[model samples]
Target: MELRDYLRILHRNWILILALTVLGGAGAYGYSLLQTPTYEASTQLYVSVRSESSGVSELAQGTNFARQAVVSFVDVVDSALVLDRVIDDLNLNESAQQLAKTIDASSPTNSVIISIKASNPNAEMAASIANSVGTNFANVVVNQLEKPDGNAASLVKVETIEPALVPTSPAAPHTAVNIVLGIILGLGLGLGFAVLRSILDTRIHSLHDIEAATDSPVLGGIALDPDAKKRPLIVHADPRNPRAESFRSLRTNLQFIDVDGASRSFVVSSAGPGEGKSTTTANLAIALAETGARVALVDGDLRLPRVADYMGIEGGVGLTDVLIGRAELVDVLQPWGTGRLFVLPSGRTPPNPSELLGSQAMQRTLEALAEAFDYVLVDAPPLLLVTDAAVVSRFTSGVLMVAASGTTKKPQLTAAVEKLNAIGSRLFGVIVTMLPAKGPDSYGYGAYSYSVQEESVSPSGRGERRARRSKTEET
Candidate 1:
């Protein structure tokens, strides 16, 4: 993924990331509160080599010997020999090995000073332990290690420089530092989880995702409205809504899909059901009619037709009736709004919808409707659900695939495209529906001008046009 993609994921899941970060900080702070307060105290000891010689060369050799001995002396501070003596003197319940864990020793290179530090729950005890450990370690180095033969006076002597003082603050529970580390750790985990979720998510939520799944240019995206179910026919029910504007945008984009004029006759389909194929078809027809163009909206989905219900027109006798010669096109074609747009509702639910849609009579019906109307939009069944759409697509200009954002899966879309390819159906651009109004893939206002002249077809004029159309069909 590119930087933008990572940034998008972070932006999309910022709430989760922030919540986890705070939770981590809270957890660390609570853990620190439960921990015992440990205070640290340190004491310094200066090691020196005593000699009878007063010459400068002899004094330099004594100082060099003290420096070399300090290295070994620092290690002995944490040993059992030194810690056991300190534990006995302080009456500490801990053993020499356990007491050593609380003590640390270090000496600066080329220096004769050895520093011993001890930590404990009690501030006074910590200081006493440090002072006692330093004194015991010094005595052991001078009286024991220096006089290994126990025959003569020892040359090494150690003295105290800085005595340990009682500490007022804790050393282990660094609250501020722990919180910072907790935040850092939380952010890492949150980011890792976000990337994993994005990778595992197979839903098609953006135009780029749809394009990646199929070689189809996205014509337009419809903003998702929570109240869409209450107002499915948005173009007519709520014309000023942003969603209605999107339908108009889709209409405009569909007209200019290619360099030349876009194809007028195409079946709107989806990979699966409930992807807004019917709703898109209804709105697009209304948008086209708003431009003073004669549009024929056909309910091509015979088994489960929605165009008649969405248009509020009679569906007792329409497309199926015309195809079976039971009714003429003009008799059943209903006009909607104050325009030339006509609705060819699916007359009745036929058992063999797929067979009827692919029949020669259905092709002739579509061809005649194509000649009669400037645009013919067929609301067909889902490609994955049934073969009706795939069969009907062969007779139309192309198939306009609709994919619901965050709902449609990539595999379903790919399979739909493959189905179209196998049937040699022209995969006319995609239409992304239910896109969020906010987020990375957001809907925006259009800047380009469209030729939407306000030319309303009067009721009387529509009647005359219907009469003329009927006479022509008869002739």
Candidate 2:
């Protein structure tokens, strides 16, 4: 989409580019080794016209005739007239027609000099062929085209000027040059393939893609953790890990979404399932609770409840029972850990989940919960699957769509945002989750100020550091 995006694609596929370049060079080297080495030898001959007249005009005419005759001699060298005698003198293995392929003849521009070049597998054989072809061409020019000295005035005379030299090395199989060309071709193909993949892939992998499609600001980014399935609540499982630090970063960014406090009561939903929506929601509540704020994480997904399991809390009864008047709101609100965070599981699956989520009772319960706690984070169902989240958003502040990096498609995420907008519900912002653990998308920035004191350094060089939570944006 931009120069930085293309640069990132190249950075990600650098290995592929390097491997293809090496393979191309190797292929070129192997092809060179298999080719037959060829040796070339060249010779030069001078053509002249003799005149008996002592006048300057006659001398000029003779030189002009010789220059015109040189062109005809060049073409005649490849003909059978000269080639037959060359083959007879040198005893070549090829026929006259076949020998033409190995021979090259040409004359310099506005000059009476003809050059003969021959190529062969043997250096000595190539030199002999060039000399033989030149000598035969001279004989053809003197006898067939010009009169003898006794018969009439001799018009043309041809003589060998530079003899052919034995070649010391092969002219073909330029290994280094071939290898360079191969490298160029390989890099071209690699770049083309990288660009093609980036264009064809519709999946979202960065905060830029989300921001380009929606009006919402990018609130935070979560690094991809392959082992997240084993332990969904990473903030509670490993408090000092980098993945947990990402959640805290998200918690900090959430406060700055809107100065009017609309983000405190928003549903976390994705374009589809398996995008770490529940895990992000659970971790955000934990991070918020760490700030001394009372947070209630509700499993609003009647079909697939995960907040209770992720938090390791009771899931037998939750928001559903309270909405149906079967259980009291105070009785079902369960406190977690040593902080003020609470978990409200999605009691049981209901056949009509949409109708119940949009009921008047659901609105009253959400409002009551909102007033009771500082933040009410509802882990609603995916927006694409059902209208429950869209319906529930009317009761809460808005929706915070979490798009999974490298998995959620851009069009799918766009449709989800449009669904909320079509219903006149506000989308708080977007959270890009499960991005690569490194690069620009990672959640380690200068804004997160943390360090260790030099005096606290341990003997093994490991020290206990402290991080001061950011209360507001830097000026």
Per-residue lDDT of candidate 1, residues 1-475 (tens digit): 7898888788778888888888888888988999999999999999999879989999999999999988888889999998889888989898998998898888887999988899999999999999999888888987888875757878998999999999988898999999988888888888888889889998987766886799888888888889988888988897766678778888888887652234369899999999999999999999999999999999999988888888888898988888888888889888889868899999988788888899999999888888788899999999998999999998888899999999999999999999999989998788999888788766564322223344558866762222111111100
In the predicted model 1, the residue pairs found to clash are none
lDDT of 1 at 235: 89
lDDT of 2 by residue, 1-475 (tens): 6789888888867888888888888888898999999999999999989888979999999999999888888999888988999888987777999999999999989999999999999999999999999988888778876767677756788888999999999988899999998888888878888888878888887777787678888888888888999988888898766778778888988877663543368889999998989999999999999999999889999998988888887899888898899999889989998759988889988788999999999999888888888899999999998899999999888889999988899999989999998999999889888888666455443234344544588799898576555432221
Off by over 4 Å in 1: 148-151, 258-263, 446-475
User: Candidate 2: misplaced stretches above 4 Å?
Assistant: 146-150, 259-263, 440-443, 446-475
TM for candidate 1 is 0.89
Q: lDDT of all the models against the reference?
A: 0.86, 0.86
